[model samples]
Target: MMQAMTAAVAAMAFAISGQTAPGTTTRPVLSKAEAEPFTPETYLRYSGLYSAPVADPWRPKPIATGRPDYLVGGHGFASVQQAVNAAFRDGGAARRWIGVLPGTYTGTVFIPAGTPPLTIFGLGRPAEVRLEFTIDATVTPAVWAEQVNAAGRYAEGDPAWPMFRSCATKTSATAGLCATVVWAQSTDLQLKGLTITNTLLDTVDRGTHQALALRTDADRTQLENMRLISRQDTFLANADDVTRIARVSVRDTYLEGDTDFVFGRAAAVFTGTHFHLVSSRKAGGGVIFAPNTAPNYPYGFLVTHSRITADAAYQTAPTGYLGRAWDQGASATGYLPGSTPNGQLVIRDSLIGAGFNTVTPWASAATTARPFTARIDEGRDLNDVDHNRLWEHANRLTAAPAPAAGTTTSPGTRR
Candidate 1:
């Protein structure tokens, strides 16, 4: 059995390395460029991803004020997964609230599709209710399944059992998808006042070890007053299908990491949030956002009225990069112009504190290493595939470094 699992993992890794493997579907590539020429009007159009009105008021209410259908910690369910399983058993279309009391809950939590809409919030402050685990991207799916199911939280008949099985059967190409502490695949899912951390910070080197705190692959996912702490690939706002639109909204949250921390293909909006770049990764600096928006998707990632700050170690020199285009699955030389996933991001009306390279904040593409080139000087379209699609408008830099608390000062003064 161990030998069979090892062979399966090896096959998956080989398949992920670009060879066509059985049961693996290749991402569709565009034969011709269909994207409209980007202009100020284009930016306005994409901004609708953030400006559009949402169905529900994406806010968190105190647990004391409302009655939660299920509870975790204290005299409640032994684990968050147990409470979620109970909610799944009492299946309904109506929203189910799960109030999590103060304490640290370890292990993976997978919220599968077809479950009732959920609002999982902490009773105390975000720090007081922590959900954390440590798993790097290099682990195979079989091994990951053993570790996650060691406590038997997900039984064979559990509602989330299939979800766990799906992740366990993933190949090396999708192994990173299994490293998340909280993987939410249900629409209208709300998480608030909690800290989801992946404690794989210093275990591995500052390489491609991706340990995600939270990964949302559903539409209308709302996160408020939450903290996602990790090192690489921390918070993934992803869509199950690249062709389908998935939207996520994060408000008043704190995300801390080093490289490509906030990344994915979802149309995600961050408002009044704080992004802290830890300097413990590499000597120079690290990247923050790595969006792999589809070729024709107008909306990618929008960060407005937020603060992107770095640690005090970067006070003397600027090294951090604002973002990079994640041309996923593209070879270093075989990247197609209109076919590959081009990341689109806009940082407007935000505070970009010190430690970022002012001259060239954006970096090269992740997979293809495509150089960052914007043609604003030549008045060319911003979304042109030839140039990187990262743009910033009305973003000011802070002359002062981050404070001792690791939060950036007010954006009142500009550099």
Candidate 2:
């Protein structure tokens, strides 16, 4: 099955590479009222698995009982960046642990590529230790640098200062890349029991602005018991390059956002997590996941044993979508399938709440606005790369029941 799917994807890529004209065939777009209601069993029977076995969960070893290598908050260090700088200066391939006490540290943290194996964890609950900022994608790099270095947090002698300068000198085309509150580029990085938030949720209108809470661009990154909050593009599981593999394992975490909250191109697995979709920007509802997986790379995202819920406002109306493909760098008219990045995602053994659209859960492509076309609907083999690469298997949904005060209620049964 896997070999056939790979051959099909490769064949599709080869076919589109030589094609000059758009395909003539068109699939019928079903309306919300006329579309058939979504059934888990029926959907799985048609849309076969587009997933593979993920790597085992990776986690950083717990800090020893003695004083940590570096400490943030209290009398240790003024900011998390300071501790990270100290770690870089005391450079070695050995693991370095930085324990953060209970306090909110507001700043943009940039962990450079050459840092040693590092783990920055909170001493208390995730809510007690916060690393937050409010910077949107529209901000220019120069303006972002000023805001980030306003308090003189990053001094000239600091090892992170040069890294910050490198990021600040990015072009306007990559303005959105600098809006991350915490960006880590070191391999074997781990974050635990902390809250990272981008407070740009209500500052700007609901548009294409992306404010990332945490962006990891390294391999073997693990996040445990963390809270990531934002609006669009909350937590990015990124890679240094498309060819290089970056695997992130997020376990027992709480992620909250409105649109495309969890997105990126890395091979990420989210297990035992809670994905909360807020209704603050309810104009067009919201999307939960957007994976921009490379054409050749099979693994994109896998969400297993997780709960995906939405605000109470969407319980009755059901306006949210499960996810959509982020066709990054695809042209408006010449969106050649198989050649371009086709996102692949699988949500198995999970509980999808009542707020998502029952009939058409997946939305159109994020960048090219390509209509959501599934290979199964076209009578082709499953995992055909010519269409949207989204699939689900053995998933369940919550029953439809009126929500109670400050809580969403479900019928005593699972669908």
Candidate 3:
């Protein structure tokens, strides 16, 4: 059944890719009233097995000492990495709860795969516990070329060498550091009540700068009541590879970014979340999401019962786009097998602030065409009709009011 479905999806993707020609046959656009209603069940159904499966509550057995398996700061371990190392030494069957005291931590944290069931929770409020780093994607190609040649991470004539050179030639941030601040490659991981941030100031002038705070590539991962702070590529919902679909959920969390921040190809669901748009150098305006949903994956990214706001600095430029279809075949980054450029996003029952232009909130990152016009670039265009897989139902946004000066955010007009 799965193989048949995959074949059908591939056929649909091919059809959509060929539909961008002038005077060609295309799918008819659906009017607002004619569109299907966006609901939680719709998202879950598309998510398929990638959504969190029903499991019994996780209750780790207590040790005789009655203490946490590891503790960070507050006189325990001096660093988060230290605690993680201790957890590794004790093996997977030991105590599973790792407690973090209220404090600001500045460093990178890695949780490797096949570790064990773990729950890392913070004792204080979100503002109290912060794991942060500063690395911007501003290194020039010349500098990158010299540095990589000296380090010998890549050699000429290799299949991946050209891809590396291409990325180096582009203005790239520290892709390694930008993409791996808090990488969780292990399954059954849970992080709650803390803030993970990348304290790098990114602007369009910086050139392809991508500093990410957290990357969740594990299965059945859950994050609750946390704040993800960054300018670009803030929170990436990803998977280990293309064969298996990973599921991640962020509930009652805060995510802020400028461009393609909340992105990736994983089956991710954001419920009761707040999305903030910081001032970006992209004068065309920043995009909130760039979902590269695989053709076979029905659910890409779901933003439901959430609020999206923008700072006053975004008033002059065009309003932000709710999301842009990030088709994979448009660039070298999307050149992997089982990759499809078609994007699937659902925005439903959310209060959208005036920061988004109501008439055309959906856009395409692969092309320069306006919203609702499908124009794939570099002869890889797919389904240019904006409303094809991207749907909006019962979303309410008020008319734009005059911008106010200060740090205050204007409330959205909720009907």
Candidate 2 overall lDDT versus native: 0.73
Candidate 2 worst ten-residue window by lDDT: 14-23
Model 1, 374: alpha-carbon shift in Å?
Answer: 0.8
Tens digits of lDDT, candidate 1, 132-186: 8988878888888888788888888888888888878886654666888999889
Candidate 3 lDDT by residue in tens digits, 87-134: 755665543877888999876666766556677878778778888766
Candidate 2 per-residue lDDT over residues 221-268, each given as its tens digit: 888878899989999998766666677778778888888889988878
State the C-alpha lDDT per candidate: 0.74, 0.73, 0.61
TM-score of each: 0.81, 0.81, 0.70
Report how far residue 25 has shifted in candidate 2, in Å: 15
lDDT winner between candidates 2 and 3? 2
- Higher-scoring candidate on TM-score, 1 or 3: 1
Error of 3 at 312 (Å): 1.4
